[model samples]
Target: MSSAQNLAEKPKYKRVVLKLSGEVLRCSETGDPISWDTLRKICNQVKEIHQLGVQVCIVIGGGNIFRGLSGSTDQGVDRTTGDYMGMLSTVINGLAFMECLEKMGVQTRVQTSIPMNQVAEPFILRRAIRHLEKNRVVIFVAGTGNPYFSTDTTAALRASEIEAEVIMKATKVDGIYDKDPMKFDDAVRYDKLSYIDALQQRLNILDSTAFSLCMDNEVPILVFSLNDSDSIKRAIVGEDVGTLVS
Candidate 1:
């Protein structure tokens, strides 16, 4: 067997929390609603990881459906109200993802911070752990069920609560860059960075609150692009595919 196959057989982490931005679910190429193709692609990636015997939990953002910060200005809504709307958006994404995973033959569950019994289970820590132990992928929705808190923070909080080995942050960019990679020609990417360096230097890998919580809890983070095929598997297998922020 190859080294990658050997590492995959070992299984390093008992559990991990993946943070996916809602924008990733949307059809960015077509400028329409959620794309079935995009959803299927992500589902396949998750399915591949699930087959590896790694317990996976996901926290999805609502930026694709509704960005609170932008909604407040564009729609003339209050900040708190817009944020609440954004939280609901995450629930929608979670449900869609759950359906996709189920279709792929991967048993999955959706746990919402906000009580939505009709759609999913309530956010219970023990129940979540039990699901992981049973080899079910749990998708966490509703973004902490409160305003003024980003989903990035939710990822950290859930990781710490569930004792996740690492936080895999899925972003459009491949990794943390010194400058906006799209806007600058010479943006630098760090292979690995200390938690303090990410905070002090403001690397933009994650929100301040999320970074602080991860640092305090000693939870390492892996920032990578979800669009990259096999990237999730690479991350779980300890391959050098993205920026490692610990």
Candidate 2:
């Protein structure tokens, strides 16, 4: 059977939550501001899924602009304060993504966990649902408006709240591996795994809090490489292109 046929045969999830790290927005070589090339690539992928009539919601991270917690120890800033700064960074990313999606002629809305009336609407579950119903891609930012919560956790929370069928985690790595695939050439890539196995092995796939949330809520997560052309489309269409962690 063809790959696309295999993908079409898998069970289809009605709606999904996608989590994107901020670093993916930046240039891989320079690690600078949002790369237009990368943004366009992602936009194309999202557009493909949008065309597929899938209800999509996105949670973007802020490591590219500023990873506050990572720098807190060196800068002597409180962890909470640093985390808030990280949240703000996500807003910036949301705006950037909104602009790109708009340029692509795709309707999008940026909603933040924290209120920013002038910039974006505060996250309201009902309103977000409305947007999705209207075929508008919703971009959720600000990481739950709380310190210490990563975007991954936010993804899980939002997915559960919205009753999404699955959460799609876009990462640098193609799938979840037994070890750091980049460092360990012999690492094994898993096609499917239980949340318990990931936790027991300490796979470093999703953050502990995020993993716990998914486990408790029974929300399946698919980890895949964002750089792969048409990955988001393939994922939304039920393709087995990544590690499925349930």
Candidate 3:
């Protein structure tokens, strides 16, 4: 069979947790945070996946607007305060995603680990499941509602809670490589990596806590480039489009 035919195979995942870094919303040329064009591109792709009958849950980071560790810390903000600020950034980002998805006519909800009654619903396991059951995309926000926990860990925790089949980690890079792909031209990308190898090699594709949660829960992770249009859809369809870490 042809490669295109192979790519057209039926989807294998019924439900998934999509982890998107806030950097995905940035404009490369102008370096403006929260580019509407970028946001729309991602939302459109998400709508496509939603139409395929997959229960979509998104976990977005705040690195683009504010990171707890960097920028804030370097500017005299203490770690705890900086992290809280970062969490707020994620809420803002989650609202942005909810707006974009709703505008596309995709049913959506923003559930925050940190409760903000006026802005979003609290993260309740049963409620989140019901939202998915009703075909509404759930956007998890606020980074576990705790300081020191990365958004990556939040994605893992929520995926486990939501009973998602897999965690689809979207990044700018095509996939996980042995070395920094941008700096090292000879860096090799792996098609599949065992959890043990990933840990032992210190792949750093995901935070250790997040990786551990997935390892303990036996939840597979697909690391792929968001630059590839329809990449999330392709991952759900079981295409060999990214590095699979399991």
Candidate 4:
């Protein structure tokens, strides 16, 4: 069936920011940082969401390639310098992801916090919004271009700047669990939670700084696993697929 036909189901939000884990680029337990097969699958999912007529923005993590905070402790790299390296990793990830998306015939634009004009346009709020208006997927990368800031916080910041309806965090786990689902088979999954409840309960799905930004802005977030091929489509199509935090 055509993607348009498949996503004929209603979309809950008109505009959203999809937060991708760096693992999305990892092929497997032992594979290249960017696995073509996995990337193609992810591109296909994003295409379906675009076809649904909902505006799409994305913030992808860089843990698959490098992590700034880890380098400080493990490699004894200067914390500031390591964070900058980590930011660069995100740009590379964006480039690789863009290549796959273009191959799928999707129109996209990569906007970086730390502008490398030759590679991608600088992060321009109005320009990014215009791209979304034109149905072009905009990828916001480079993790706020600052040390000590995480991609999770970047997602929240970008979502607020773009006035996105919600932040859709794509995780490997199905949804927020009372405990680590993998470690405890009896862990309970939360279907719905208020922002205050999430904070009070100390849910680890979103970092405190990032979570606070969403709470302050009144942006709802949906956390769902990306393991299934149709999870993106299902979540945006208003299906009960993940934990909803409002």
Candidate 5:
């Protein structure tokens, strides 16, 4: 088969936004903020799909380093200041991811919503699109360049701006469950969910604002487990790998 034909058979979406939580990079065993082993595995999966010709954009959270809301309530940090600190943390994760991806021979660009001229390019919609068109992975960091917004919202916004076909969220659980699966063995997983149902039920797979943005944009969300070695590749190939929220 021609290379194009082979690639066509593999990816369901031409472009996608991958949302990752910073906690995924944490070393659970050592209490370290970033785990090279975990990062490497995730990057390899990203490389796998990129090789299949999928245009990938990434938005990762900073919860592993700090959470703004929690900092405000728990540590008495001012909300705006706490949020800015959190945003900086995401930039750190983005830089680490960019370095790893480039080392793997995959071209990548780190675009920040906030200007960090020395480390990354300021996000420009046209430039980001051009990078994807040229097959360079683009990692969007710094969370909307404002406080009072979650990384989830940033992912939804970037996905809509880039016209990504889907937002693939790598989570701890394999799919969205009625209850916390880790806590409740009887928790039921939904293979699919409608945005309305998810909202009415108050499912916390994403923040309400993020969910609403995606609903309005009509972009599907795929929630899958990062623990699964091949989950990302399976999702990209349109396999039944996780819960589908539309």
Candidate 6:
């Protein structure tokens, strides 16, 4: 069936920021950092939503390649230098993601906070908005073009700038749990949460900076598992697939 014909269902949000962790691209069995299969799966889902007429903005992390905080604390690297390495890693992931999406026939653009004219367009607010207006997927990368900040913060910042209706954060688990779901069998998943409640309970749905930014901007966040096939589509189509933080 044609993608247009498949759009019988409408998405809950017209525009959204899809937050992806670089770890999602890892191959567990092979221990490879960038898994083509995983990338393909993710791009396919993005394509699905794009076909549904949702303006997609993606912000991907670089944990799989490198983590600045971990490098600084664990490897004795300078914080600023480590963060710049992490930002470079995000650019690599963004380029790979853009390649995957383009191969899948979805129009995509990568904008980096740090200017890299040879590789991608510099992060320009007007240009990014114009890309979305033209139904192109815009992927923001390079960790806000600075050190001492995270991609989570970048996601929140970009969402606010683009005026995205919500931020869909794909994680390893199904939803936000009161405790570590992997360690605690009694961990309970929340169906929904208010920003104040999330803050009061200290639910680690996002980093403090990112969480506070979302709360301040009133941008809702949907936390869901990326392992499930069609989960993005389910969430976009309003199927209650994850924990919603508003």
Clashing residue pairs in candidate 4, if any?
A: none
Off by over 4 Å in 5: 1-9
lDDT of 1 by residue, 76-180 (tens): 989999999999999999999999999989999999999989999999999999999999999999999899999999999999999999999988888888889
Tens-place lDDT digits, model 6, residues 128-234? 99999999999999989999999999999999999999999999899999999999999999999999989889888889999989999999999999989999999
Ranking by lDDT: 5, 6, 3, 4, 1, 2
Cα lDDT over the full model 2: 0.89
- lDDT value for model 4: 0.90
* lDDT by residue for model 5 (1-246), tens: 998767545888899999999999999999999999999999999999999899999999999999999999999999999999999999999999999999999999999999989999999999999999999999999999999999999999999999999999999889999999999999999999999998888898778889889999998999999898988998999888889999
Q: Quote the lDDT for 132 in model 1.
A: 95
lDDT for 73 in candidate 2 is 80
Per-candidate TM-scores read 0.95, 0.93, 0.95, 0.95, 0.96, 0.96
Tell me, by lDDT, which candidate is best. Answer: 5
Clash pairs for candidate 5: none
In the range 78-109, model 4's lDDT, one tens digit per residue, is: 99999998899889888877888888888999
> Least accurate stretch of 10 residues (summed lDDT) in model 5?
3-12
1-246: candidate 2 lDDT, tens digit per residue: 898775574547668898999988888787686888898898888877887778889899998888878968878878999999999999999998899999988899999989999999999999999999999999999999999889989999999999999999999889999898899999999999998898889888778898899999999999998878988887777677889998
Q: lDDT: which is higher, 3 or 4? A: 3
Q: lDDT scores for all predictions?
A: 0.89, 0.89, 0.91, 0.90, 0.94, 0.93
Cα RMSD, each candidate = 1.6, 2.6, 2.4, 2.1, 2.0, 2.0
Clashes of each: 0, 0, 0, 0, 0, 0
lDDT of 3 by residue, 1-246 (tens): 797865575568999999999988877888987999989999998998888788999999998899999955589888889999889999999999999999999989999888789999999999999999999999999999999999999999999888799999998898899999999999999999999999989999789899999999999999999988788888888878889998
Q: Worst lDDT window (10 residues) for model 1?
A: 5-14
